[model samples]
Target: MEGRLENGQYWQGWTVEAPVGVVVFVHGVHEHGGRYAPVAARLGEAGYACYAVDHPGHGRSPGNRGNIDGMDTTVAGVAALVTMAADRHPDVPVFVYGHSLGGLVALTYLTGERHPRVVGAVISAPALDTSASNAVQRAFAPVLSRFLPDLGVLALDIEAVSRDPEVVAAYRADPLNHTGKIVARTGAEILTAATAMPARLRGLTLPLLLVHGGADRLMPVSATEVVRAHAASPDLTVRVFDGLYHEPHNEPEKAEVLTEIVAWLDAHLPPAPA
Candidate 1:
């Protein structure tokens, strides 16, 4: 079904079991909810209703293409999604899963005061530390943001970095597949998350699984290393996949990662109330 949030963003999602737990997905930059269909469908097959929403200006959601504006808004959107999906499912816990930029947003949301009702979260290839994007963005950011909230720049292009050629090709072929108009402010938000990660690392309590690709060029592998180093949550687990690129869950070894995720979720989230 298609629905619009109070924030004016739209979502395309599906639910399987009535009153069963919910899983919401926040996709990374330049992509949409459609990319998560395979993963979400698998989760549904496992008895959990899954949802994937395109963030503002990305995917089917209405806005400029690839311009997320900031993490705070997207985090709010995730919280709102949990509340709304919770309304539909009611009796079960709702988990939020995010990849790349989405992972940082989920982290920020989970650590804050008004947390979502999730028993656990799965963060794949998270952007948790500084890299080349950090330096370039900070050096030339303010000037660009002032004039170009949406300037249609290519950040490595979707095709160049994906481990899955078909997924990369599908994105390039999609009518809404956008390589243009990434908001400078959105870039800034990602940096802020990268900058503040250290101080905030030890405060997380929610069950979390951080997955990263050793060969990821967009977000450094050190990103997960930093999080694992300072994490106060004893329940947190980190998995680094060899030879995988940015989106580890979509990599060739995705089945292994998915299996690990399902096991993590099963242990953390109790079976639906009988």
Candidate 2:
């Protein structure tokens, strides 16, 4: 289905219906929600009503490719998606599944917003820290974002996306995936979010499950430690898969990684009505 936000941005949504619970998948940068349809299908088979949406400027939604006005806009996009799911299935527990940049968005929403139906969040390879940019790129991104927001500043390396060659090739061939350099403002917003997220996570009090690839090059595994340090979630669980790349769910050990996710969700899911 499709929906338009108050800011005049249009978003495309996909759903796999079930009754036990809801899992809203938040995709990474340069990628759209459609890329996660397979993952959502898996969750649906586990009895979850899965939901995903393409952020404005990233997928079927219209905007300059590979750019967003700010992280706030992307965060709001997910918030709207979650609200739509909750409104459609009231009383069904909602869980967030975020990967990479989507991880940052999910964390921001959980800590900053108030949504009672949201039971917990599962974030995989969160982009809390980025190793892709150098000191020079980081220093200049903010200034360039103000002066030339649309300028492409950093390019994503497809080879670093996964350990499996097939996954990397498929990602490269996907027309919906933004294969160009990230825009100045988008890069700046991501850097800013990585820096500010730890502090905001202190306010996170919900059940949280964080998983990451031990060898992820794009976003370092050390970033997860920052969440471990600051997030006040009493039920936080962290798992690191050694020898994997940025996209753990798309990695070679995908089954094990996904099984771990479902197990966590099953454990945390609210008790079914009597």
Candidate 3:
């Protein structure tokens, strides 16, 4: 569950044994991979192997709270885990399931490298861009970070800090989750990712399933809508679940959500190019 990489960075995750292809899950900011236990069990019961990794500085992964810069290191770390997973399951289709920040990290994993040769990907409310907070963060972060570099003073109030009681409750209950704290550098990278969403969408030829909650306040559906509208991938599909929040997989109808993910993964990820 916990191990240090050859590179010295500590990583944490869950591994489920199955004969079928392996599905590696990456959780978002503040949350850990354990939150995906039920989904992993569901998929495992259905015969698919699963590996869920906590991002650096998240969950049991070793690092100070909210210290991953630029997200590239996190993506590379994911590639490392995928490589290890591949060594165990040779030639099997490797699929990635990422949520919010994890989704972006998944995208980051695929963007500039060809390490794992992932078969397909599932992105739930991937925060490709920070929607509309870039302008202010870019301008004000320099001033704020000078005084309070560790104040978690990034843009976006996030739904957790809003008037929404349910969102706050769920966030508070998750011990693996962090508070409203993102470094200015991290904020800049998020902006870069959001800005590149259009180009990424055009070039992402991999089979992708983008799921977004219709009621999500933090990661608005427009991000998914735009990607679905413009993605050049012939196999891209978007699912908008009614009444779900930013995290549909962890929502009340998580069973239904996992069912849809498993079904989609089953349909797209064939055994292999035998």
Candidate 4:
């Protein structure tokens, strides 16, 4: 259930013996992969195994909280998980699902030079062209990153997470839910990745399902539109929930979102050979 990456990062995950397929999940910033247990459970009941890993500096993994040295490291970490899943489920296809910051990592992994083979990807509220910080903080981010990489910049807005009041309350009460400020370097990296993501989308040929909340203030629906426009994949699909917030999977209409994901996976990935 728990192990360490070759790079020494700790990871927690689960797998099934004979699954129709597997979903490798990459969670949002300031949150560990464990939060997806419910999502994983739902997928598991559908005959799909699931795997997730805490990003460095978040969850139970070891690192300076809320800080990442570079996006490459994060991409590599996710790629490693993909490899692990593929190795364990060689007969079954694997699909990647990323939310928020993890969505950025998933996108990067799918488009990057070195990446594991996967059937498709599901991105939810990807942080492609947005940062949590305000204009003032954005303007001075580079200088702050160089001088004080660890300096705390922006506090996460809990209210922006989901439409469900209970989900918001649970997030606030969860000890693993990082409520801390974003570090200067982390903010800088996020901005850098967001700015560079569009050009990268042109190279992504993998089947993709990009989902976002039309009312998501954290990462707007417009960002997902940009990705859809440039993505080279002919199989790309986009779904914008009219009144949902950042976390549609945690919203009141979560069943619809989850069902959409499952249906997409079922359509794309055929059953493994006998």
lDDT of 3 by residue, 2-92 (tens): 6666655555444555556778887887777776776777888777767766676677677666655446778887888788777767866
By TM-score, how accurate is candidate 4?
0.94
Off by over 4 Å in 1: 18-20, 114-116, 134-137, 152-154, 271-274
TM-score of 2: 0.93
lDDT of 1 by residue, 29-71 (tens): 7777777888877777777788777787787777767777667
Error of 1 at 83 (Å): 0.6
TM-score of every model versus the real structure: 0.90, 0.93, 0.86, 0.94
Q: Model 4: residues >4 Å from true position, as ranges?
A: 114-116, 131-136, 271-274
RMSD of 1: 2.2
* Residue runs of model 2 more than 4 Å from their true location after superposition: 1-18, 130-136
lDDT of each residue in 229-269, candidate 2, tens digit only: 89999999999999999998899898898889989999998
Give the worst 10-residue stretch by lDDT in candidate 1: 152-161
RMSD of each: 2.2, 1.8, 3.2, 1.8
Scored by CA lDDT, what does every candidate get?
0.75, 0.85, 0.72, 0.85
- Order candidates by TM-score, high to low: 4, 2, 1, 3
lDDT (10s digit) by residue, model 4, range 1-274:
8888898666666666688888999999898888898898878878898998878788777778877667888888888888887887788888999999999888888888634458799999888766446788779989998899888887778899998899899888988777888888888988988889888889988899999999998888877887898899999999998999999888899888899989999999866468
lDDT at position 259, candidate 4: 92
Task: Count backbone overlaps in model 2.
Answer: 0
Q: Cα lDDT of model 1 overall?
A: 0.75
